[model samples]
Target: MNRLVTVAEMTLRELVRRRGVLLLLLLMPLTFWLIRRDSHVGQSVRALLLGISWAVSTAALFATSAARELEPRLRLAGYRPHHLYLGRMLGLWALGLAVSVPFFLLTVFDANNLRYAGIAVAMLCCVAVAAPLGMLIGALLPREMEGTLLLLTVVAVQMLLDPTSSAAKLMPFWSSREIASWAVDHTDDGYLSRGVLHAAVVTALMLVTVAGLFGVRLRRRRHLRHAPLV
Candidate 1:
């Protein structure tokens, strides 16, 4: 437990130190929110949620990429795979929440007649799903640029695709859109239920995938087997 907490703390500190990255991440969502502010409240809120997910996931991707070299060393120092990934994930989730709070408050003050609770839930879902998704991408793609391009492609699809289409359901941030519909459009309870379920399932799958990847990649190999004493 202490080890996990230590890794998480280190992750938080490391990310916080990247002042430029933090500023950009914070700006992305605010930009999204501002773009649609005058057009439609629901669109603005939905875009805001997507921006939050993108920002957090991007952070997670960069964090995981940055730690790729250090993680093996940490493993040598007795850190388990779960400790490494889960701890970093916890930190990213915390960061994601911090990024969401300002936007949440923005909605509160700028948009009237919203189900604020649903917006909060959507933000939680975004943070929960995004962290592992980013880590998974970071693990698979050795180059940060490649992983970033893929992440951008996914987010672009999520934004441009029709939410009602079957293909849109596969997108990681779909739950946020669904719940945003419930919150903004005053849709039925079914939307909320589906959104929550989708978020839970996606988060579980991504975490498992990331764990497997990290385990294989970080496993210590017998590259130099010791011989019997001469």
Candidate 2:
């Protein structure tokens, strides 16, 4: 448990040290939020949520890719696979929440009569889903470019699709949109319920997938057995 916390803290330190990357990541969501600031409040907020999801997932992708070589060494040094991945996830989730805070505050000041709580829930869903989704891609695709392209494609499809379409529900960030609707449009509780359900299911699925992949990759092999000493 302490090891996990230590790994998470170190991961946070590493991200904080990359000042340029953190700034760029922060700029994206703010840009999206501000782009529609004058035209439509809902659009700006939804865009902001999308950008937040993208930023965190991209960070997760790069973080996982960067750690690929280092993880084996960490394993040799007595860390388990969960210690590495879960700790990294903890760091990424904290980073995601930090990135989200200002945008959330933006809604507080910039918009009126909004269900701010719903927006907060939507953002939570984004952070919950984005990290594992990105990690899964990073785990499956060895190259950063491949993982990035795949991530972009998913977000593109998500943007272009109609939210009511059955297909949009398949997108990982759909819950954010649904909950955003509840937040901005004053839709009934059904939207919030569906969004929460989707977020839960998707989060669980992605987590299981990531754990399975990590377990397989980090497992001990039979050939390296040690003989008992006399």
Candidate 3:
């Protein structure tokens, strides 16, 4: 537990130190919100949620990529795979929440007649789905450029695809769009329930996949020899 917390803290510190990246992270969603603001309330809100998901996922991708070499050393130092991945995920989730707060406030002040609770839930779903999705991509593709391209492709497809289509339902951030509909359109309770269920299932699957990938990657490698820890 202590080790997990330590990793989480270290992850947070590392991200926070990247001032330029943090600025870009904040700006991306704000730009997304501003782009759709005057068009329609639903579009604006949904865009904001997507932006948050994209930002968190991109951050997770880069974070995982940055830690690739260091993680092996940490494993050699007795850190388990769960400690690394889970701790980093916790930190990313915390960062996602922080990024969402300002935008959530923007919605509250700028938009009217919204089911604000539903918006909050939708953002939670975004953060929940994004962290592990990004990590999984980063794990599978060692190159940052490749992982980023894949992330962009996923987000782009999520945006262009029709929400009512069956294929759209397969997209990871679809839950955010569904709950955004509930929040902004006042559609129905069904939307909220479905969104929550989808987010829960996706998060579970992605976390399990990430755990397996990290476990394999972090296992003691035969090529290097080092003194056993005392």
Q: What tens digits encode model 1's per-residue C-alpha lDDT throughout 15-82?
A: 99999999999999999999998998999999999999999999999999999999889998889889
Best by TM-score: 2
Q: After superposition, how far is residue 46 of candidate 2 from its true place, in Å?
A: 1.0
Between the candidate structures 2 and 3, which one is better when assessed by TM-score? 2
**Local error of candidate 2 at 214, Å?**
0.7
Q: How close is candidate 3 to the true structure, as a TM-score?
A: 0.96
* lDDT values, one for every candidate: 0.94, 0.92, 0.94
- Which scores greater on TM-score, model 1 or model 2? 2
Candidate 2 residue lDDT tens string, 119-180 = 99999999999999989999999999999999999998998899999999899999999999
TM-scores for all predictions: 0.96, 0.97, 0.96
In model 3, the worst 10-residue window by lDDT is: 218-227
Name the lDDT value of residue 23 in candidate 3: 96
Evaluated at residue 213, the lDDT of candidate 2 is 92
lDDT against true structure, model 1: 0.94
After superposing candidate 2 on the true structure, give the runs of residues whose Cα lies further than 4 Å from its correct spot. 228-230
